[model samples]
Target: MTLDDILNTHLGRRALLKSSLAGGGAALAGTLFGGWIPNVAWGADATAKYETPVVETASGKLRGVIQQGVHTFRGVPYGASTAGSNRFMAPRKPEPWTGVRDAFQNGPTAPQLGGPPNPLILGHRAPTFESEDCLVLNVFTPGVTGKRPVMLWLHGGGFAGGAGSAHSFDGNYLARSGDVVVVSVNHRLNVFGYLYLGGVGSEKYRDSGNAGMLDIVAALQWTHDNIARFGGDPSNVTVFGQSGGGAKVSTLLGMPSTKGLIHKAIIESGSALKGVSRENANKTAERLLAKLNLQANQVDELQKLPMEKLLAVIDNRGQGTAGGGPFVLAPVVDGHNLPRDPWDPTAPEISADVPVIIGSVNTEGTFFMPPDSPQFAPLYSLDEAGLKTQLTQRYGDQADKLIELYQKEAPGANPSKLFFMATAFPGDAIKQAERKFAQAKAPAYMYLFTWETPVEGGRRHSPHTIELPFVFDNPQEQPDEVGNGPDLQPLADRVSGVWTAFARTGSPNTSLTPKWPAYNTDQRATMIINDDWKVVNDPRHEVRLIIESVKGRAAS
Candidate 1:
């Protein structure tokens, strides 16, 4: 029979077939044809389209798509479905499959309370679906032969909601430009990931509090075992993330299990010096159980709760913080899994030898206070009096001093800009850098992204995730956020070069920018990344000190 007749018969039999040739009949037919069915083919176009790339992974063979010389694999499972009995528990290995599975479509995001993307994160798109079986990852590589550097990206949404499959995080440009293997992971999040059932549940649920992080550990293990097939060097892996993803990278640094798995690390904006304390974790657990009308002895019922019912626990709530503020759902510092805080009093000794690149944007706070939001609209148009009133409420006696210092740092700067800078200056980034430097075994490089975007009429000056498109060399993907100016591509080139350079070696020194120095307590040498890149010693030192002083005074 002809191929058309065969396909027509197959389709007639399987009316539920999807467009991607991902149906079970395709694999069944592969045995006869010696190849999987083409994604786009009929009678004449079948031969050319059937030449898609296939890679053998540890779990099974995955059929991926190749576009412009970049082999891209999406929705590749790293772990089993965390549904039913597996909910709130540590990740388990995925079962071995027989036939070639399609890896062309992106995986589902974790069960999260869905919402529209924040207007400030322009061009940002949420994943189309959410499911418990979200322990998947995507890989992009130039070719599946050479041992190129592998970069594992963790997406940001403060651990509550986000998927690595988001369009903004596509690794095509990064993989092609850097000639590296890029992997973006989709792990559990929100209540499904970090419900803190260790203390309340039975012995089997001991690691439940930090299950989300354990999912990442499983992904790392998968990478170590299977990344080589995707043209990645297992030894030269770099764990990098922005915002909550960055906090995850920080949390992984302290993890005993992550030793030797990660050779390099990068934290952008999100600096998690510590995790949710066990006491707080227990409290959150108690609150959740109380809300569910369940007792500690009946904690097993948590696994049976519907995903949407559990997600409603944090409904209408903002994203949780690394330090367990706002919402209680986050990675916990359970004694068994997390052991201790990642970087509280000191950097984790587990990753003492791992080099790190830590940084934040110039106006990180502007993201949270987008002009379009009604709650934050007033802050954008704040006068000097309003700034003083808000600062006084926060800093008390030290408000005027902070205002003076910020004004001196930026003459003619608006009150709203000053307020955001004062509040959003991530002290944790500096703390992480200093603590890493204190380790003495590995060097820590510091940077401050000062490149402003023309988005929202320049209201968001170097806002959070502004460096993301640049770091991924994907300015065109998020044109609204990064803008399509003449300077965008060049900046993206340099930024992405620095990141890939760090992944290739331990240092970020490349021809893309000038000589960057290691961060120290004295020099505090930080690379000011902008159109005119320059190394600045303690940039805005006085402002940082004054803002820090408020904390000191408040503590005193």
Candidate 2:
């Protein structure tokens, strides 16, 4: 059967279950489905209604629309356009306007080339619009009066691509459910955001390499100054993101400019330990200059060049992953903005007071291995011998030891499963959690999402970005990634509750889940979030041990 045929079959089965369960009440349905059943519908509570909401900001007044009891303001500018001389420079406050500006639709995404969607990863959509004038944010709130908690979401594109306007990131459900404010930001990215020009450029472009990070800082400042009008508590703001967005949160935690503006942080799947060094960033910039055949003094010519011309000089391979090359663009540890790596040797002292929730999914590797890709064909049906050979190519002498340990931990697991688990283990998430625990100033909560998605015949297995729909309480928003099963709403209710609770207080504990203990070196407590949520101490000890063994060998 074709891919569409397989998807339809899965949907048909789910529909049958729903039809059979319709006779029983929600409680009975919950009993049969292995989880709680939510009373609310996936969409709006009542008939969709739209009303204009005007909120004053530091810059000017913004007119937004309210639908289904949630006031949503989109395309709200946080910074000025970075098109001309502003290219590669720190973001500046938008010029004030006299009349109220309409924020009806999403702002432009950072100028990025689009790539074909990967069938393996669910809800894989590219940014709708691209431009240098993309320093805008979207806000969703229950009301524009009470001082509810505020959450700012950073979109993930690996510091290379992505925008806040992606459909999967809709904040209406999340904001209404938690009675909090949700903000999603769009900022400069790729060469426009991270290209380093400090060495060859004038004094004004010294902070060019870290302009994107600075844009996020600007967004935070905007929220701090203006979210109160949207009924959000600026003092109780939490920043959370997945994948590249998570790496941005990690970077923001270390930025001195983000002090006091950020109250809490959540790093999901993407844990960045360090940023590109100044030397490496400068070299990349020099290479780009050479590619353009421009002299040192003529650096201003870059600002005059067309956007297409500048983009063409670089290898704009595509988005899902950072482009493959020695000159991949990313944040720089510039002395001014970012003094050091975010979590290299240890957690940044600047964010010691900030409580954090750090976690990774069970199978992050599946997203990278699309079944149709010829390069990864062996990974889908690898035998024991093939697994050993594949592991040896990457792990060298430790391949046998890894195999023995993984088999001991997960007896009867197939060679493909074993290899994926052993290889895709997020050791960095553990290290980041440990570093936060070591800080001792703030509490750290840990979690592992092990819910295997039933989509694509269960091949994904809780892959990267799978938890996004649940976290946003919009499982119905992306049915492909999260199947349209009877259990989705309840799971989303539980997961979104955890996130909102953390934003409200500095803890993820809620009545929906069990009593989650703080992560420490002793118990290494972690909340295994799924249909049957439970707190587990060191969920994967073997994985940790294997990581330690790898480090030990590397050190020797």
lDDT of each: 0.82, 0.81
Q: How does residue 82 of candidate 1 score in lDDT?
A: 94
Q: Report how far off residue 55 is in candidate 2 (Å).
A: 1.2
Model 1 over residues 304-388: C-alpha lDDT tens digits? 8888898776674564463235457788998867889999899999999999999999888887776878988898899999999
Instruction: At residue 442, give the lDDT of candidate 1.
Output: 92
Candidate No. with top lDDT: 1
Per-residue lDDT of 107-190 in model 2, one digit per residue for the tens? 666787566676633343544546787888989999989999999999887987777767678688899998889999988888
Clashes of each: 0, 0
Candidate 2 vs. true structure, TM-score = 0.88
